[model samples]
Target chain A: MRKTFNNELSKMHVRFAEMGMMVHEAIFRAVKAFVDHDKALAHNVIVRDQAINECENELEKMTLEVIALYQPVTADLRDVITILKASSDIERIGDHAVSMCNATIRMKGSQRIAEIEVEIAKMGDYTCSMVEHVLDAYVNRNLERAYQIAKDDRFLDAELRKIRQRCMTVMQAAPASVFSGSYYISVATYLERIGDYVTNVCEWIVFLQLGEIVELNPSSKNNL
Target chain B: MKVKRIRIIRTFFSDAIIIFIFLTVIFLLVIRQVRNGSVSAWGVETFLLLSVTAIILAAVDIFGRYLRFRKRKQNLEALNSRLSNIIEGTKGKHVLLEPSDPYYELSQSINAVQSMKDMISKSFVTQQRGYFSLIEYLTIGVMVLDQDRKIYLSNHAMSDLIGREMNLKKQLYVNVLRTYELSQLIERVYQDRQDQHAEIKLDFSDKVVDAHVVYVPVSEHHFLVMALLYDITELKEIERMQMDFVGNVSHELKTPITAITGFSETLLQGALKDPKALKEFLNIIHQESLKLTELVEDILSLARIDASPELKLDEIDIRKFIINLLRPFRPEISKKDIHVEIQIPNGCTVQVDQNKLRHVINNLVQNAIKYNNYKGNVWLKGTIKKDSWFISVNDNGYGIPKDEKERIFERFYRVDTSRSRQNGGTGLGLSVVKEYVEAMSGKITVDSQVGVGSTFTVIFPLELPTAPLNESTK
Candidate 1:
């Protein structure tokens, strides 16, 4: 009886991982689109997120079914529970990427905002790495490594803030540049928000790894 | 009845006395008659009376001897049965008596001796079974000593535990000590007579044996001692595992938290005066804070699953369930340019805890999309087989390694941990999926190869039970 239960759990894990792959792809392309400023690619990222949403729903249903039937214990129980949590994070990550795409579309065709793309690109890159690192941390049960990625997210935020501050100063120096500066700020903000989402994923990873609800940031680091 | 039997014997004695008196009276009468010349004298009559009296006395003596022997035989048989029962693995108090079966005073003294004997026997057996059983069965080493420290019982397990068979009888338990700790315990229990226990550590075997001893006072001058044993090898291993788990979790949580808190503190101290620095700090703070939230949420979910596994369950249609779930993700799918195909029979239902099952299905489907190739098509299929409904989500993505598949369900376990994080996986997804699936009495499996793609299947048995309805209630 226990063997059968374990077998069932194995199947569920595979399915969850499969669904995870889709969201991972969506985010992957979304990051690429942000860097290349390819409208078509950005559109693709948005479109793929729908599949991620569908997967999120389906995986949740599967996990619930398993819990009802098998009543797994110890590690098996923890695994299913972690999947339920991970799907949300994965789905949210997909949403954030698509949202970024939307932001890109909004800021498109505005030449004045083009210069800020560099900073936005930097932020996007850092956010992308954060997203990737947290996913890996989740899989590896490397809570330490996962936390490090979360810690590294600070750098991405700092870049976004600097871009935002520079855009404001430019707007103040040349009142006519207000429109352009606003776009820069928006892009910076979007990148910063993406970083936030990535951190969210990491927090869940830590929780999943440890089976405890600890703050991802150290208590002493909570000044912000 | 005994009094009546005694009365009958007394009556027989009186009757004999009366018969003697009558015979004497008859003789006198005959003598008188003969003297008077009324009758002829007869010697034969006198001889017959004398012979009958002799026969009656002999029979009484024989009967008395027979009664005495019968009583003694009954008493001996009762005593023998009691002794045998006590020896046959039963515990209690019973007295042993001397061989003499008659005389009430002597019997009482014998009973006293019997009590002491039983006490000694019980203590002996208890001690041998308690301590020797472990040494005999679980380990190799067999050695036991009596109160005087004489060897009493030794088994093969004891020999193995001790590394050799050693005669332990008649020697002081302390003086012959192979291990000082064990000897000390024996001495302590012997002196105190109260319950005492100790752990005997073995350096060679790297094992610990728990030993317990108790002194039993059987009489004013006699005492009995007993000991118990147990092995804690497996227990020690579990302790080590628990410690490792804690250590790993602590370090993992500390790093990120430190960065977030430290950066925030630095910004607050004076960085805010510079808008750029302040904004940068804020951004970092925001990101770290979000990560902390996710971590907390994951931990909460894990704890919830572990603590109250008996969540609510309900019947849900498989086809409708999948369809309803898909409604929310259509936007994401369109944006990703991914195609999702659903193959499920209409009206097929499975019993499941809705919240948990939704989580499982959501995790798997999301993965399919997140890792799929550009413009990849995901097949979501459901079928009924025997008593269960099988559902699968197939994705065309970089699949998992064969070796990593089994370990994937472990908490925080990952194949390519770094890449998994890159994909925004918390690693808890598959593990949680496994836990809920098992709890629901369902089965989940994965078929995958690196780069070939992966197929995940979930089998949920028919869960809604049919109940007979009473027309009145309806």
Candidate 2:
């Protein structure tokens, strides 16, 4: 029975890594679309988000199935629960990358302010790398790296705020540039939102290890 | 193991009890004979009793002495404790037990032998340590798995190659080596017991390694599989880039040459009499010829550099250099109506090959002009950074795709095929720019966003790197 549980868990692990890879590719391609202005890659990331969402639902079902079957206690229970929570957060991350792709699609042919664009790109980079590191931390159960990634969320947030301020200035100074500037603002915001989801994944990792719910980035925002 | 010079034997208290009973029996018999006072010939009974007592006494003495000597050496723990002190070079242990003791000489010999074994084993351990360190410090990753497929040993390089902590021992190789390709390769090696070589991808990242696994047999029943992994990710990347270059060269050559041949063949067959067709065909021929010349010139330049690439370095002010480089682009810049902004600090200078730098700067400036939207802004900022100096060419134009970003420097790689062809780009622009930058001991990086624009930065170091240059020199 223990072997059965372990095998199920290993299968889940492989699935989870696959989902992580998919999300990673989505984030990468989404950023590429934003950077390269490739609508096809943007549409691809958008289409791929459905698969990611399905992955999350499937992951949730697997966890519930493990709970129904083994009714595991302590660490075993923590493992299933953490994965369930973290996979949801990853789905959210994929969703936000989709939002960036949506923003990329909408921003088409509008004038781009370089200053705001660079900040938005910076946010994309931070989001891409954080998702990568956070997934690794979860797989390796590296609490220190998870904590470092939690700290990294603040940088993404700062870039988001900075881009918003810059976009506001661009909007006021040149009303003509506001169309693409607002899209840039939205893209940065989505990246920051992705960073929040990454922090939540970090929280699940901590809960998996420490066996208690703890917030690595305790923010008053994202309350909704 | 050292052969024992002295044999070991142990006697128990039960043997002492049996000996006591036999001596008592002899005493009783003697007592019975004496008490009975049998009338025998003179002193015959007396002589017999005396001989019996003397024989028994001699037997007991020999047995007791042998037991005492053997018993002293019986405790292996005592011998180990004695030898440990000697091996440690401590003064507490004596080579010879107290000289007054009956078995002191025998103990001395055993102690001498014990110390000799200790020295030999100690040296063996040090030699083994040396071999272990050799594997530990090897640049190529090495792992040895026993027949059970457990990781018998792995080095630091192994961990670095896989980008994981794998210093653990006796772990199943599959558990440590996450990639299916690597694990399957190891399994194959174990099954065939033959040497195998492969290029395996690390699943998480695009890291490639040249893997060589050897089946090492220790005995009939025992064997090991040794895997040597050297990271060839960079090498594979260069190989791919060169392959793209070669493939592009053929494709680039074929297109215009085919157009030239077809147009000329059409003119030769029938169209010569029709002035309109003649003029059109000749124009087509002329255009294709121009393209052919451009391609040939680009190819020859690359070949010249490939033959013996040299750098002639000189110090030039950055702001002045950029403005001068932008000289050729002024007419195109105005035609595109680009808002060219140069924010390089005055007196900012670098030592670089002048002609090569001119080519590098010109390629970037021309790209900025070609790819920009009407009234698009071109920003050039020169900054002297620690360890390196850089000038970034930032443009508000259609940016490169993320996937194609890595390949953009490859010859004939165009993000937008139609746009580049429309713009009359040979696709060799970035490739030549990259080559010249590397030849001048520099680096280049591009950051771009789809609709937003692109930034191309050419960086040169403050100090020459001691290590050799990249794939070009090789």
Candidate 3:
């Protein structure tokens, strides 16, 4: 019976990893679509969001089943609970990827905001890396790495502030670009939100280890 | 020492009291005899006798009691020292006593208890040895950590995985496991008192380890965390290759299907009404469909070869086989004004499956003709070796680039897709040639230089095996 329980736990881990890769791909393509102004790629990213949600549901169900049948306590219980919560964070990141795509679709064939696009792209890269590292930390149970990722979210936060400033300056300098400028801001905001969710994942990693829910990014506390 | 002295004095005092009581009884008896006039006389001689006897008897009684007290005192001292030695964790012998000794029964009981302890401890040591040996020989890496995240135990596999011998006892887990991911996993198990799991790529080595961390509750208040590492680098590589294959296949199929659908849609929309343009559009559709057909057929043939690699052997005249294989490509060769040369010994025979060998020759010859420049030369040469027949196809065409030679046989791999498409070449032609050549107990290799020429040499076994060999062995 213990062996069967362990097998189920391993299966849950594999599912979570698969979900991580899927979300990573989605965010990557979503950012590329925005930068390249590819409507079809954006549409594909939007369509793929349902798969992420479905994967999240499947992971949650498996976690619940393991808890109910095994009635595991201590570390076993902590593992299941961590996966259950982390999957939701990952699913939210996937949603933000779709939002990124939606923002891309809104500003179809407009004058490219070169400076802001560059900033958003940087922010996108940071957010994707955060998602990847945090998931790895979760899977590996690397507490120190989880802590490092939590700290890295501060960098993304700073980048978000810089992007906001640039978007405002561009809009103020030229009124005609305000139409596309607002969409760029929305994209940046979505990326920042995605970074926040990644921070939440890093927090989950801390919780999984220490059984403590810590607010790792202090600056984001008021917003939360 | 004081207590023993007091005990001896107390024993002497009790003995003196018993003697005194005896003397009083004797005096009373004498007095009664004298008063009843039963004795002749109460004389000085009789009194002297009674007094001397009583004195002697008291002396002997006191002396015997002193000897017994001394013996018991010595026995008690020896037993006390031995018990103290045992309590202090020293190996001490049990005090030996004769059956007649005063403390013999106590000495026997102490010895019994000591031996029982020895037996229990020896069994425990043996069991511990067995447990450690079992873990040491296991193939999977195992590490145990205490609640403080200190390394308690590790096996041989753990050392191999870490790429070093580790003295892990009482050492913090992070100090031993260099990977941050693994250290954190151990910490998670320790803090949460639950089983955790992770896959870690090692920084010190190029190995991917799948770690399963589990919480072990030794008692109500004591627990340990165990991490098991399984190397999964090979599995990961296989998974990546499978994914790449799927991606490449889909991409390859999508292009032709898109072209066919798009061109046909253009024709149906209005181009068909324009008679002059209709023929050209129809021809493009037809060519794309043919390419698609060739691609599917190549894929199916590869699948068949993979599923069953057994070949049906037939003896073929080399000169005749070369002529028959090049017959279909003769028109193309002549159209391109390419010179064809066949240098095969007459009456020389090779054993192979006729149909599969035909496919191999057909692909090589077709590639030679299609890639040849105008008025270029194509050579088909056969030679006999000790155990094999070497067939070489030489083409003086725009030769393959140096870097692309190795990947030319990969499915759907084209160095220049537009050029190949314009020349009506399906990208699967070389890959199919490679697969068929190998399926017939042969090996294929290419020698090419850009702007010079290419020679594709296929070496077939002189005699194909009569019985099927295991596919994997080949």
Candidate 4:
């Protein structure tokens, strides 16, 4: 009986990894579209978000069935629970990436503050790093990496703040340039939120490895 | 693991007592019915009754022992398979033990061992996985160094970053990294057990990488260090190229702008009174403006090449193309008193981008004419291979130095800067030729001997990809 349960758990693991890859691609393509003014890529990211959602639903169903049928305990139980939590975090990251792509589509062909755009790309890089590291932590079950991922999120947060401050200063100098400047702020905000969702994932990894719930980034201000 | 207490002696005592009482009652009843029978006369019947009771009790005890032993045998088999499965990292069959099985406690212990094995094997697999398989796909190179400052594990990405495949296990960290500062950084991280990130240039290829050294505590006292090396060589190259390009363009533009302004100012400051001086000054200004215009146009087209470049392909006879390309160069060819030889077959034809091929021919032929000595020999050859075609332009000109051969195709790089500037060369022809050639999926190479001669070859693939490559911005 436990043999069947373990099979189900491993299947959940594979599907969760697929969701990880999809979210990673979405985040990557979304940032690329925003920076390169690639509307087609932006639309692709938006459309692929549906697949991510479906993957999450599939994973949740599988996890729930395993828990309901087998009633796993100890590490086995923690494995499924971690998958449930991490999948939700990954799904939310996909959502944020889609919204970022939306802003990218809207900001297409507009005059951008060049300096701020460069900073936005840097912010996007940090967001990608955090996402990748958190997923790595999950896969390797590395508690240290989870904490590091949460700590490194501070870089993304600082990048967003830097973009915000610079955008304001530039807009004050040339008020008409506030159009793309606003888009930059919104895009960076989405990246920041995505980074936070990655932190939430890191927290789930901590729960998996240590079997405890500890918020690594409290200032992320997660409501639920 | 539950086992019920079974007392053979106690159960046998109870059975014998009941049988004895029943048989004794039967014997008493018989005696009461008999006319003159005594208890001694029924000795054989009593003995037979006792023998049957003993036989029945012995039969019951043997059957129970046989059933319990069979169960124990089955349970032991299940436990064997279960234990083997757990040891092999697979889900094992349940060792369902009957309460009376002798090794029920043994099966229970296997269950405990299985769970512990699960945790242990899971960690081991993940650790080895991160060391080899998982990190193999990562673009960032990862290496783990043990407490003895020796290589514990590394992935293919690390070998790729190091520019060679090597036996990385058990090697010293300093030997593998080949950067003293990086070794020092690892030492500092080990001392403080803090994460440190630095930009270090590898000694092998001089690639700049972000060396993120993390102090990974393996256990309580013993710790290892993990270095995540993210190669930013391409990024640094792009940044350096952008900076160099900006600086070069500004300098290239400023040279002529300064001359135009300087001579015009002189012309206004009384040099305009002398008729010859006025005419020469105006001519200098005109020439400088023309050079400036040429430079600007070259820079603009280079930018276009950096964009999505298109190759207008056509089938052209190689001989005819060359003859047509050399038409405008005839004056320079004759002025240099050079003998031009075209050793190409009459039927050599290729599917090529016409204008791009023209640019390639123009640049090489123009350079040959400009650099050749008086009566120097210049030869051109075209050959069609099975899968590729190449055109070689050979000239007995002042050849390039071996050190500068690679940089000749770089933008704004000129061999004889003074001579080319005086000849009104924009120093962009070879680089432009390179761009045009690459747009048509071709390569350019040069073989030169400083005083002997130089051969510039342009080779193109016979077949073209029907679909355009993915567009990447420069």
Candidate 5:
């Protein structure tokens, strides 16, 4: 029975890793579609969101089954619970990826302000790294890495704020592109939300290790 | 030395006391006899003689016993030295004792025990050698950790995985592995006393390894953690490639299907009432259908190539083959004002599948003409080697970038996606060409420079082999 429980746990780990990879790909392609202004690629990203949802549902079901069957304790219990929470965050990140793609689709053929695009791309990269690093930390049980990801989320928050400010100025200057301008803001907002979701994953990792629900980035909570 | 002297003194002192008591008793008896007047016939000489004889007999007996004691001590000392030598594994001769010596049988027993020990130790050494050799030659990485989490054994495969030889004896597993996932796996195995598995990516090496760590119980209180590492990077890459292939196929198929559907739906939504609009839309529908047909054909060819590419080989005249192949492209060549050069020696023949070879040549020529700048040159050259024929398609056009040269032949890999779409060329052309070329027992290579030119060459054997080559030959 213990063997079955452990095997199930390992399967859950693999599924979580796969989900993390899928979310990573979604974010990457969504950002690429936004930067390249390729609607087809954006559509592809949107379609892939369904796969991510399915993965998350499967992972959630597996986690619940393990919990109900084994009633794990201490570290094992902490790990399963963390996976449950983190998989939700990952699924949310996937949703934000779709939202970013949706924003890209709304932008259509309009030219984005070059500077804001760069800023948003930078934010996208930062959020992606946060997600990737947090996933790695969860897998390796590296508390330091999780803490680092949480710290990096602050920089992403600042970038998102700057992008939002820049988008407002651009909208005021070019009233004709207000529609695309709003999408630019929306993309930035989605990326920021993704960063927050990654930070939430880091928090879960912290809880898994310390059994304490300490927020690593307390100030970002208000923004979220 | 002091203890031995004390032992000797103690032994002799007891004997001396007993002899003294006897002497005293004899003297008292003599005194009694003299007092009773019973010694009237006894002389002093007789008395002295008796006393000397008794003392000599006592001395002889003591000396004889002492000799025996000394001999026994010497034999025991020899036996002890031999035993120590055997324990130390030194080559030493056994002590030979006289048969009359009391320690003879003891000496024989000591020799027998030593020989048995020697035999057992020799066999143990051989077994150890065999065990180490077996481990050294094993392909799977193996490491054993004792109950203290110290490394007790590691194989060559383990060292290779680590990228260096490690002094693993008594070394902590974490200090050796340095990978947190694997270390955690080992720790879990140790704690749970069960087999555990993890997929670990190493920081120092570009490898993904599947590690199986098992707990081996040596005794009631002693156990070992054995870890086996199997590199799964290639398997992972293949898996990713399969996933990418499926995704690309879906995306590629979706584009034309969407286009065909949209245009037909527009026509059906009353665009057919406008004659000019209807014509344009029908043309687009026709073009998308053609593209769809090409895509399906390319997919089928790729699938065929994947599933047993059986070639029907035939000898073909190179000059005639080129003429026939270029006949269809002649009008396009002239329209684009591109210079066409065909340099094939007359009577130059090679063995290949005629239909597959035609397909290969056609794809390369089409790509050459389609991608070439206006009035650029396309050269088709055939040369003969000792055992093979070389056919090359060289184009002076918007050449491929240097890095993309390697992947240009990959299925659906395009240098510029929009450009390929504009040129109306399915991206699978080069991949199909590669497959057909390889199917005919040939090799293909490409060289390209950005904005300069690109040359693709295929080499085919002069005569097709009657039998298949060994699979390992590839």
Candidate 6:
């Protein structure tokens, strides 16, 4: 019975790690679609999110089972708890990517691209990097790096500000460009959301390791 | 000690009986000698020796019994102190006793009881902490009263709500009885040991606090009273805003919609013969369609922000960011007589969702420029302090009213509704700012007065590359 419990726990950890990786990949692929304007890639990312969603459901069930059956404690319990939390965040990131995919499809419908595409692309890239780093941090238990990625979102905000100014200018010059501007604005928003989910995942990772939840930023330490 | 006393009494009785037997034997021998008219010296000597030995042995036995009794009494007193300590020790943890101790079974049971008590009190402490923290965090006041009508516990929120502790010793219902009808209901329930609920408006200093009271009998001698505070100030404002939103949408759209429908009706009735009328009707219809589109877009954006105010943060270069931001606004800068100054230092970075952050900054700067007089200056500055980054936008424009400063962030809130309408403001910009700023773990504050200028400053964390501070981590 003990051996079986151990095997089941290992299986759950493996599945949770896979889910985190898939979310990381989805975020990257969605941003790539935005940058490259590849509708096919966007469609793929949108479709693959279903798999992540399934993984989330399965992880939740497995975690609940472990808690009920084995009644694990300390590190073993922390592992299950973190997986439960991380899966939710991963699912949300997938949903955000799907939203980005929908935004891309909308932009395609309008067939109008804005002049501030670079700014939007940069924001997407930065957010994707954040997701990738956070996932790696979770797998390797690299809390410091994970925290860094979470804090890095503010820099992304600065880039988005520039994007907005460019869009506003375009809107003022050509009133009809408002639709295109709002679309790009939403794209920047989706990227930012992806970054936030990554940070949440990293936090869960640290919590699993330390049995404590610490703030990501130094300034915000006062909050804790 | 009682057993030792019994032993002592038995020893004294045994010694007296032995002494009586010895004396009787000696007396009988003496009587025989007197009858025989002669006595032996050895016999007398033997009698005397036997009597002395009995007396000495009795004295020693008495002293020994007294010592044992005293020792037993002292041991009993020590045991009582040890038992009391086990029950009410200062340490929260419990310790088991050895099995060989005199009160081993009792000690084990006591230890078991002590352990259970520790668990209960630990959980109770945890719950108390959690409850008070929630109350303190909430913008509500809660008070718990005993059956005697005295305050047993009051949350910090409740204290802040009532402004002072005047009602701490008094009947809670009596204090707010005049302000709310619900207080009387609570009083009735508490006095009668029945369930009661009430809603009262509390004057917490200048601000009015809407309080919902629920009185539940927790025990025969104690009652639980909960006061839920809903800062109706915001709720009332939201209600007004919703009314204005509906009113504004209808009023704004009615003009064009009415014109289009009427003109179409007229044209259908043969007014199409006149080219002027036909062109005018078509123009009105086009304008109305545009208005509908704008209204739909505003509604959609507001809904989106309200539904998911969850914006993510990422890292970006501050110097390049500012340069990039200003590049597009160059035209606005050149066309208008406004001076746009960026006072942010190079390499300054923050963590926030790039898009929402941009939206807020763009809206503020745009508003500043839009409201500024000709040749006016709009200053955009970012300063980093010990723990946070403060971004300020100052504009010399039509200032806001003191009351409106706080309400300006409400959806569809406007200082001058007419002027805002003329400027094509949908009144959702500041509300969006507030939502995004708060979502990004930042605070937005505005300092303004009538006839003076307004300065809106957004303060966010500086070490934001790792994570934004939120309640979950704490």
Q: Which residue pairs collide, candidate 4? A: none
lDDT of 3: 0.78
Tens-digit lDDT track of model 2 for A51-70 = 88988889989999999999
Pick by DockQ: 4 or 5, better one: 5
Candidate 2 per-residue lDDT over residues B356-379, each given as its tens digit: 888888889888889989989999
- Candidate 2 segments exceeding 4 Å error: A1-62, A73-79, A98-113, A132-186, A202-219, A222-224, B1-205, B208-243, B262-284, B308-325, B342-357, B379-394, B399-409, B434-474
Candidate 1 lDDT tens digits, B1-474: 033566556656665666656676787687886697444554667657754774485357546755775676566555555556546745444444444645444446545656777778789889977856666565534355555544555556554454334444554333223343454566576557676777776432445777766676678876666555556655764575466446545544665689888988897788779989888888877887786677667767877666656647687888889888878788768878998999888887666788888888898998888877667778999977787788899987656655457666766565665566666655567878887777666778998654446799988777533342122112
List, for all models, the DockQ compared with the true complex: 0.01, 0.25, 0.02, 0.01, 0.02, 0.01
Worst 10 residues of 6 chain B by lDDT: B172-181
* lDDT of model 6 at position A199: 71
**lDDT for each residue of candidate 6 in B409-443, tens digit (9 for 90 to 100):** 87666777657777776666787788777767678
Arranged by TM-score with the best first, the candidates are 2, 4, 5, 6, 3, 1
Estimate how well candidate 5 is docked, as a DockQ score. 0.02
> iRMS of candidate 6, one decimal?
24.3
Work out how many backbone clashes candidate 2 has.
4
**Which tens-of-lDDT digit does each residue in B1-474 have in candidate 3?**
334767656655665566656875777687787677455555787657666666667668867877776778888988888777766656778789999886899998878767777777688889989989989987788988777667789999888887645446886555445454576676577567788888886534556889999999989988888899998877976675567567667877777888889988988899889987789888888887887787788889878777878777788898999998788887888899999999988988877788888888888888888887788889999978898888899987766754468778877677666577677555777887887787776889998654456899999878776566556325
| TM-score for each of the candidates | 0.33, 0.67, 0.40, 0.51, 0.49, 0.43
**Candidate 3, B-chain TM:** 0.50
Docking class of 6: incorrect
Displacement of residue B253 (Cα, Å) in model 4 is 1.1
Interface RMSD, every prediction, one decimal place: 26.0, 5.4, 14.2, 17.9, 10.7, 24.3
**Any residue pairs clashing in model 5, and if so which?**
none
Cα lDDT for residue B297, candidate 5: 90
Candidate 1 is graded, for docking, as incorrect
